[model samples]
Target: MKRALSLLGYSIVGLTSVALGGCGQSGDAAPEATEVPKDFASSGPSAKAVESQFGTPVKDRVATIGLLNKRNNLTQDLVMKTGESRRVGNVIIKLANCERTLPWENPPEVGAFVQVFVEERASVQEKLAWHKVFSGWLFKDSPSLNTVEHPVYDVWVKDCAMKFPGEEEDPAAYASSSSAAKASGKASTAPAVAPAPSASPSAAPSPAPAAVPAE
Candidate 1:
């Protein structure tokens, strides 16, 4: 009986030690942390080559973008120049370039090359961090061409303020020219009026020797 009791005690001690070792191993193991990028709002790809006739170089042009926050149903306009970035709340928007069709083009269009970053978690287990949600050219007229896919946000191009070579005609000059033409047309079409006779007595007097001569 003594031998059997001693063997049982030894077995219990070994099982308790193994269970504690397993717990220690699990406590030491941990998930690897994700490395966040230093540049959260990196620029998008380079813009396409544009001719001098196109007007406004890519870097000099300004672009307007619309940012919508679905959570609050609030939309805001973000006007930014090329190579610029703006942060609103936990989101960042970067503009690389913007473009528009020539004034004489048949189907006019405006677009902007943009990158969007949001501080959000990739998954439920992961912590919140800056992640690029979209990066590409977004068109104002044809929004379906490219879209920013995010659950809580939407971004679209509004306008690209740039001009073609002849687009910058002076408005004052145009108005003056139009007014002159209209005035000339009216003058040419008007009927001329004859002048009224003079009221002076010298012009109205006439001699009266006719009755005596008839007898």
Candidate 2:
């Protein structure tokens, strides 16, 4: 009976040790689960919705676009020329071309072709990498025409830097023109002042005529 009791005590101690060891191993091996995200891409800009129109050639040739970060609601403006790119956080934006319609054209519009590259992980097993997520023309007036299909970022057109006739002139030019107009108006309204003609001596001629008549 004494031997049997000793054996039972030894068994209980061994089982408790094993249980503690298993719990430690489990804590070390498992991790918090992360939910995989779904793709956020959408088809945008039907052919009929965004018509590409270009009249005046691009002058300065620099394109400007607005970028939005959905996670934090932050927005930034990106300026680039054709074949130029700007990087932010893990995203890259490249410009191809920007265009605008002539002033006379109906329903004025502005558009730009953009390419977006993003750094993302394809899956849990893969490492973070860069990928071209979206590339298309985006319109300033109509943003729904094209969309950047990523979980973190959104891009849209603002306006093309090119200029057209009958459009608003440069601020410097406008100011100069205004100043000149004001000067012209003042000149036209103000009356001209002239010096009066001086009267010359006729006394010598009158004296000669009086002497001749007396002789």
Candidate 3:
């Protein structure tokens, strides 16, 4: 009986030592940061493309996008503009440009060119790796046009908060133009004036012609 007990103790000690060694090896090698998508590094549009499309980049302009962390049931807005990128958790999102039709135009549409990178592990024990999961335009009104196909995340365009060339007018210029239009409208709407009374001499000549005919 004592011999069997001694053997069991030795087996427990060996298992403990193996567990400790594995822990030490894992601690020595830390996980690395996720890398950017290859497409973003290669084919992402440059600043010149922005200028060509938008005339000039509006530094203050921004596009707001909704990022859904389905794993956590959380949502956040990522505001960016042309040639801007944002990193959140295990995902990286970049905005190339955003567009919206004019208020007067029909079939209104709003869309944004977006790229998404997700960090994932090929297996449960492997380190996290990043890959481009989705890269294309997403629409605000029609999200079905394009989609992010990740099981853990979903991204959609919320709004593009940028001004177009003629979206707004200078305060002074607008006031002046408004006043001039009002003046023109008022003049066109003015009432007519009555004619002055006829002279007494014209009345006397009319009576004299009638008396001569009677005589």
Candidate 4:
């Protein structure tokens, strides 16, 4: 009898140990971050067209525009001219690069202008996840110490290509793969939510239905 009781106790301990082991294994395992589209190839020939048109380098993890010398607005304008543009959401972006001559007039600014197109009531808010621009100076001038790089321009280009037709500016067919990912259970990163439109008090509300005339 004593031997039987001891065997029963050992069996219970073994089962409990196995259950705890399984639970620990589950606790250690976590879902990996879903890999959305990273390489520019998914854009198909559209991205390739831009690369060939503007000579944008697609090496490394980012597309490099090389070094640009900021001379004046003229240099900046020249670079802007090289870009093939498209509208993303409410912003218009141009993809181009050039050697800007650092102007000697005022504070002597030397850098590239990754211009972000702003509509009447809209402008670039905070940094959101998207393609970004890469630029730097050739040492003729120095940017303010407080200045930090905002690759929003590149983000704009990729976003625009994915969302809107660059030549036509249609929003529906051209949206980014991120949109499709969101439709699936893949991309969960929420975009910046815009505010709701306000109604004017001058606009009167709809009238209630009149009381029934007949019973």
Q: Distance (Å) between predicted and true CA of 192, model 2? A: 49
lDDT of every model, 2 decimals: 0.78, 0.69, 0.73, 0.34
lDDT of 4 by residue, 83-199 (tens): 334343333343333232222224423333233332332236745443433222222244342232432222211111111114244323334554675676543433322222234
Q: TM-score for each prediction? A: 0.57, 0.51, 0.54, 0.18
The CA lDDT at 104 in model 4 is 21
lDDT of 1 by residue, 81-176 (tens): 887777777788888888887665547799888988889889999999888889889999999999999999999999988866645685245456
Worst 10 residues of 4 by lDDT: 156-165
lDDT of 1 at 3: 100
**On a 0 to 1 TM-score scale, where does candidate 2 land against the true structure?**
0.51
**Candidate 2 overall Cα lDDT vs. reference?**
0.69
User: RMSD (Cα, Å) of candidate 4?
Assistant: 31.8
- What lDDT is reached at residue 156 by model 2? 89
How many residue pairs clash per model?
Answer: 0, 0, 0, 19
Pick the winner on TM-score between candidates 1 and 3: 1
**Residue by residue across 48-165, what tens digits does model 2's lDDT show?**
2232344344334677888999899999998876556666777777676788766555577988888787878999999988788888888888888787888889898887776655
Q: Which predicted model would earn the best TM-score?
A: 1
CA lDDT of 20 in candidate 3? 90
For candidate 1, list the clashing residue pairs, or say none. none
Best by lDDT: 1
Clash number for candidate 1: 0
What is the Å distance of residue 71 in model 2 from its true position? 1.7
